[model samples]
Target: MQIRLGGLETSEVAALLAEHVEDMRRYSPPESVHTLDLDRLRTPDLTFWSLWQEDVVLGCAALRELDPTHGELKSMRTSHAHRRRRVAAALLDHVVAEARRRGYARLSLETGSPAEFAPARTMYAAYGFTPCDAFGPYVADDFSMFMTLDLADQPAR
Candidate 1:
């Protein structure tokens, strides 16, 4: 899969993002839903990417800068047809590599606590992300699982 920077013009990316928000709404309470909307993804500090194979969009993910040295993983979703094929993994590797290039020491993310999110949590763990307390605008919530990875221990990509 080829991973590259994306913009709002990518309809597949927008569709996947909508699916992500809808899924979050289904699994999380309104007050606890933390996914960013399309507009927010356009922020200067957020770098969005899409994974594609030929003309097909496999998935999309984004990195939102929480600070100069830290970033939050956002909107990570692999298309249903692309699931179980390492699409998400590729997107994640791309994000982590970019974070390292941007001089970020830490990469953190928040996902749902439900069984529906088990695969996502597992994916994060496989990439060396360890559970952590809520960072940024988040508070400790039983329905949320927070994780972080330290870039210091990682070699250049």
Candidate 2:
């Protein structure tokens, strides 16, 4: 699969993002939901990416610079057609590498706590992200699971 910076033009990338929003609606309550829609993803502080193969959008992810040393993962979604094929994994790896390259000392994320999110939690665990208390503008919510990964010692590969 190929991953590249995405342009906002209602393309496959937009479709994947729309799916992410739908997933949020399905799995998370309104108050507990934390997702960036297309407009938010286009903000100056965030860098969005799209993963594609041929002409199909396989998945997408985004990095939001919360501060100089910390980065937040956002809009990570694997298309239903590409589920379980490591599309999300590749996008995540790309974001982590990009964060390290940008000199971020830590990478953090917030995902749902429902059963629909168990797989996502496991995937984060596999990448060395451990559960943590709320950070940034986020507040403590039982439906939310915050995780962090320290990037201090790991060299970019």
Candidate 3:
């Protein structure tokens, strides 16, 4: 699989993001949905990436710069056809490596608190992301679970 930056223009990537948004809505209330739309993911503060196997999009993820030393993970999703193939893990590894390269002292993310999100929460925990107070523009909410990794303590890959 190849991980490419800025593939959001492709229909596959757009559909994948749309699916992500739809899934988020199914698990959370409208006001608690934090998923970014396609346009927002294209902003300057965010770096988007798509994982591909030749011509097919396998997954996608984005890193948003909250500040020079802090970043947030967004839009992480694996295609339905590609689920359980380690697609999300590969994209996550790529994002974490890129964050460390960017000198980010911390990497954070917000995911649903519903049971449907348990697998995701487990993955984040395996990556050393622990529960944390809301950061960036987010506030504490029952529908959202915040997690963070202190990159400063992580050794370079």
- TM-score per candidate: 0.94, 0.95, 0.97
Ranking by TM-score: 3, 2, 1
Instruction: Please provide, for model 1 over 1-157, each residue's C-alpha lDDT reduced to its tens digit, 9 standing for 90 to 100.
Output: 7888875587777888888889899999987799888898898988888888988888999999999999999999888878999898888988998899899999999999989999999989988899999999999887899999998986654
Candidate 2 lDDT over residue span 52-116, tens digit each: 88888888889999999999998888989999999988999999999999999999999999999
The predicted structure with the larger lDDT, 1 or 3, is 3
Off by over 4 Å in 1: none
TM-score of 1: 0.94
Name the 10 consecutive residues with the lowest summed lDDT in model 2.
6-15
Q: Model 3, residue 117: displacement in angstroms?
A: 0.5
Model 3 worst lDDT window (10 residues): 148-157
Model 2, 74: alpha-carbon shift in Å? Answer: 0.5
Instruction: List, residue by residue over 1-157, the lDDT tens digit for candidate 3.
Output: 9999989889999888888989999989999999998889989999999999999999999999999999999999998899999999999999999999999999999999999999999999989899999999998999999999999887654
Model 2 TM-score? 0.95
For candidate 1, give the lDDT of residue 49.
89
Model 1 weakest 10-residue run by lDDT:
4-13
- Candidate number with the higher TM-score (2 or 3): 3
> RMSD of model 3, in Å?
0.9
Scored by lDDT, the top model is 3
